[model samples]
Target: MALSGELWADLSAERRIFCSVLLFSWTVYLWEAFLAHRQRRVYRTTTHVPQELGQIMDSETFEKSRLYQLDKSTFSFWSGLYSEVEGTMILLCGGIPFLWKLSGQISGHAGFGQEYEIVQSLVFLLLATLFSALTGLPWSLYNTFVIEEKHGFNQQTLGFFFKDAIKKFVVTQCILLPVTSLLLYIIKIGGDYFFIYAWLFTLVVSLVLVTIYADYIAPLFDKFIPLPEGELKQQIETMAKSIDFPLTKVYVVEGSKRSSHSNAYFYGFFKNKRIVLFDTLLEDYSSLNKEQTEGEDGENEETKSKTKNKKQGCKNEEVLAVLGHELGHWKLGHTVKNIIISQVLSFCLTVLSRRFEFQADAFAKELGKAKDLYSALIKLNKDNLGFPVSDWIFSMWHYSHPPLLERLQALKDAKQE
Candidate 1:
């Protein structure tokens, strides 16, 4: 008999293990949050900036950074705790099975039988997604309107928020309905080797999404205006040429419409590849605005290159420094490698990704502008109000990006090479 159907005494053993795993995960996250909170407190009280990062920000900016982290961590901790509790409820309350049963009933009422793969799968996914969305709405609202707004990062108005939400719903349904239906059909057709076929199908879909995401999907949210003829654009193209990184049209997105953080990134593959910069980043870094402490975070946050602005004049060299780091990924083939790793079923593959990050940094350093790249990194860390994770275990096992300190050290080490 299935564990769920077993006698209470027998089921208790398995339930204990599941509960323990859940509890352990929650505890680790809470502990990490605590460490981050403590780290921020230290930053707030101390005037000492790490020798490497001091060039990027002053004591005042450092305090500002610490304050941002405090707000972020506080929100992260409480929201995480709520998520854990909600997840526990969902599991123990038999909510998933109930949702499944409800989906079947709804589909059947529509003249689709329970055994119809496409209908059954589509209905379940649709309803389940709706349920997830409704449950998550309150937290999303608080994050956007309350926490983000408090941190000066929220650019969304209520009208824009609702519009984004509706668009997301429509887009998700458009993608999910057909995708889930096809996957269900494949499952019905493929028996023993279903997993192999499913993996291949997923790989194809992932590749397609990546190709279109920056070009097509992103434009759905924000406008992309071509970077005008300027020193910055010339430098960007020149750097891409030097690295032999595929360059298409360089377009700057109006990312400030959503958030006050700035970024540069390269997206797509082959002929489709393009370099994109957030307009806020260009404005912040181009003229080297000593007064502007923030930039638009941009739509694609997947790139690394943290910086905090210091009182300096605009140097096209600084923007080029950021571009060098982005091109490093394209030149080194880490982007496609990352896509492959993400799609595979592996436990340790993710940890191995830290190597790819370092390698890309090395590539950036090799392209010259090592000092500018270093400066950009410092600004990014300050701008993002980021700190190094003190917990070594969590840093190694969980962090997707290398900690800021680690990257700074990496840049320092790269210069030696």
Candidate 2:
């Protein structure tokens, strides 16, 4: 007891904190691995469509979803293990402080000197992010090329992928470096309430980014065009006007250029609100239709025929139903509520997020969109090859929205009522 006490006493606060952080990180990782194991078990054993899923999913689709999820789970396991081991090694080897000193030296060589702590800090941040990107690159490439390509989700050619990646890195650095510099400067000059100032600064930055992302940053990568005049546009405008949603413009982003996944969202504050829809979400306008008409490069008739048979997107009414759900978010103040709660009460976030989704679903139901939304949900899930089933614990930890079946049930109940 005396020897143990003496040893514990000899451990400095910094050493204790360092060891504690490592212990906590590993503990979290192990917990995640265990959760993943349970989910993977479900993926492996649930080979056929369950009685509950029979109506919504066919045997072929279910099997494809099962295999896709299994592959994703396997990939996640290896990537997660690699990340955990890398983090542990970095901490054990004092990688952070070592990199900090190296960054200082680099800045000094560039005539910035140690007194320019901001410059050294920027150098350190850049080096850190670059290191992270480099280390994760192989896993990313494997996911995009091997896993996603095999599953028919990957759309970018190797050249396009690399070009896009480089563009993203450059744009990210341009934004990150300046923002971090400003943040560090604020901290240095803020004195006692640096935390408060930092929080406010981040809040402002987030709002600004949300407001400008679709307009400025997003268009830098993907193409965005105004939703052309049509029946769909007219109906959407009518729906918006009915709810006083402050909808200003609608855009159809060519998201199919990267992936076949469909999505839609509204952004901006007050009257400047704009809705952006992935081109993949519109049955009529979807680029997936092209696959039916023409063969891709190097694709033979057999491959082209297989691709052509794969349908994507939703009907017009279903698209309107999706818009109804999205508009519900705006009308119900879910977005603003979430932002505030996320910044303040983060612990309750996951549960509250799920609740918010349900509320939005209910609002859509109230808009007489229950049946359309239900069908839309199933179609979207099938198109994305999303695994409808989830482990309870995993769902609790990770899913912000309720599972497909649960939402469908809720919508059905609402419709019946």
Candidate 3:
């Protein structure tokens, strides 16, 4: 028997919807890639004063460069807006058809009605997620490889990136699939009351996951070792003791193996708490004080000059200042406040993220001198491409971090006391 004309038309419509969504996503991705390429070109071609200038010049030049890049990369704005519109359209397009098909199949059966609906909903959700991931993976790869590499910021090898992706995918499925199945099962059997119980269960599970993330999950991907014995470590321990922070273990992470960025953080609760510094910071500090020859034999006068020119590359005082700032986040209750604020803001617009970032900045100031923090911030700012400070609202909604200028200003204001 031949298929009916109406059925053929419906199939065509579905196909067209899928094609349209894919086409729009790809177009937006391509435009973003092109803009990123242009921004990199502009950054590389632009000339600026040398970094050895006085602190004010260094900060100003860094801010200007960042603003320039921000203006050139308006692609983020366009892509972000398009992403929301495209995502909603694709969901509606795929979901409505799935619902109709499921409804029709269930109506034809007697005892299978409730079971079919539950099964179909689960299947539909899985299919939708899979489709989105598959469609989006190419753009993620492009960003990591083409865009990041062009700017010399990409530290991940293709193998590492893929391995990370696989691990994340497995973890997500392991956690999500069982919970989804259970929820659907409850909905099938418990009818209306299942939703209340499901909500409570989900909230409890989310809290547990958040608690375990820093302690249990983070170490699975990155190795953390106790910060080795050194003057800096002793100083940190002394500071912790002064604050009655119960000094136990200090650790350094192997972040430099992946990227040149330097950072420190405090993790865990109570006695389980520990501080971690990046090994890159350690290496940078060691090299700065020495003749610049370490594990690599290619190190020469040129290497030493380049290393010296790198803004605030691994200075112990700067590291201490940065770590102090992070400690401030904990000491001033910014960390706990941030957690509560995040939960409250999860359903709202992204303004809370920016505000919390400023609060952390203020907290950092309470722990360290504003000048030291400002200097570290200036160095970090100069080392990377700057985005526009005026695009706070756009960036707050799209990006995870606050502008460096905003952070600097917050520190400056806090220093007023």
Candidate 4:
């Protein structure tokens, strides 16, 4: 049967709406993914110096070069433009899908005159989300296994990675499915009025999650135990006391079981405050220190043999210096400022989270231990060298955090003052 011109017009309009919405969503997703890839390259390059700090032939020149690369990268006029592009794409990716789906469902309901269209809409939304996540998993695998492994950073077995992924999926579904269902129910009942209450609920939940992440959530994946009895523990306690940073707990995390990279973090607030040092860090620091003592009289056959044997320690001084740098971040109000700045930026720029990272690095220096911080920074850079610097810089700028080199330079500048 030949359709009337008016009916043809209506059909054409529906096709246009569907295609436009889907095309817009996919375009946004692709743009975001591209920008994120660029940012990651930048950050990876910048932090590479820190990972290799111990292996550098000349520390001073290497430090200067690292700082120069960082400054050059951060202050480049093009960098800001790239930064803006990355940021804008992220917001579009996050918001566009929701809007497209919502509008499509509304239009579908009007056209079909059927309640089942709403269910279809919800199903579409879920499928979109699932598909997005599924597409991301392959890239995640590539990064963790191929890219990281090439750079000597990947210590995780394929089994470990998949196991972790499955566990995470289960945990996320357990938490998110119920929350999402509830939110949708509220939206169905209250319509636009539910947004205000939904926002409030989201805010409260986010705060609660942050508070409990270290104590409850973190333990699910890794083991944590009190910092062992030793001079290391005493030094940490003494430093905490000296800085008037009340410390009730310090724990060593089982990070080495998963990777060779070492890290230390400070977490919790008020009475719950604690410090966690990676077991790898402790082992490496101790080994390096032992090597230095053996090589004290320059090069000799016996000394060389001893040095080779004692490759697991770091100087106690360096450890203290690194700890001091972390403490500096807290003592100088960097953490609080970061939280506030992040919230404000989330509303305004939506991408300033990465820039704020550089500011935190500057704050870390103001707290003391600049030399140790520099050494630690160098070591971190060297260890992470395989990832392209550009990817690291831009990725962190796009989503996660800040570039390592920028942070190190900020510390250097702070130390000079």
What is candidate 4's lDDT per residue for 1-417, written digit by digit as tens? Answer: 357556556667756676566567658666755665565445435433445333432454454444544433334434445445544564547655665566566657666444544544554555555655675677577666655454344556777777877777667766765666666666677776888877766767777777788788888887788877889889888888887887889988766446556778888777567998876566543322343233454322221112223233245555666777677667767666666665455433335545554544554455566666666665654443312244543444354444455555566655533
The list of candidate 4 runs beyond 4 A from truth reads: 1-135, 188-192, 283-315, 332-367, 386-417
> Number of clashing residue pairs in every model?
14, 0, 3, 50
Instruction: Report the C-alpha lDDT of model 3 over 1-417, residue by residue, as the tens digit.
Output: 256556556677767777677678768666656556555555454445434334344555555655546443544545565576666675767766875575546544535565466555655565666666776677678666766555544566777777777777767777777788777676667767888877767767777676677567777676677766788788888777766675567887755434555566777666666887876555354333343444454424222212333433445666766777677666767666666666565524246555655665665566665666676666665544544243333454455557665676566655533
The global C-alpha lDDT for each of the candidates, from Candidate 1 onward, is: 0.70, 0.88, 0.61, 0.59
> Which residue pairs in candidate 3 have backbone atoms (N, alpha carbon, C) closer than 3 angstroms, thus clashing?
66-386, 227-250, 227-251
TM-score of each: 0.82, 0.95, 0.67, 0.62
Residue 329's lDDT within candidate 4 is 68
> Per-residue lDDT tens digits of candidate 2, residues 1-417?
999789868999998899789989999999999999999998999888888889889999998898999999999999999999999999999899999999999999999977999999999999999999899989999999899889988877777777888899999999999999999999999999999999999999988898888889999998799999999999999999999998899999988778888999999887888989999899999877664444455322212223547668999899999999999988998899889998865548889989988888898898898989999999999988889888888888888889888898888776633
Please give the distance, in angstroms, between residue 117's alpha carbon in candidate 4 and its true position after superposition: 11
Least accurate 10 contiguous residues by lDDT in model 4: 299-308
- Tell me the deviation in Å of residue 247 in model 3: 5.1
RMSD of each: 6.1, 3.0, 8.9, 10.9
* lDDT, residue 367, model 1: 76
Which candidate number has the best lDDT? 2
- Candidate 2 global CA lDDT score: 0.88
Off by over 4 Å in 1: 1-9, 12-55, 284-315, 344-350, 413-417
Best of the two (1, 3) by TM-score: 1
How many clashes in candidate 4? 50
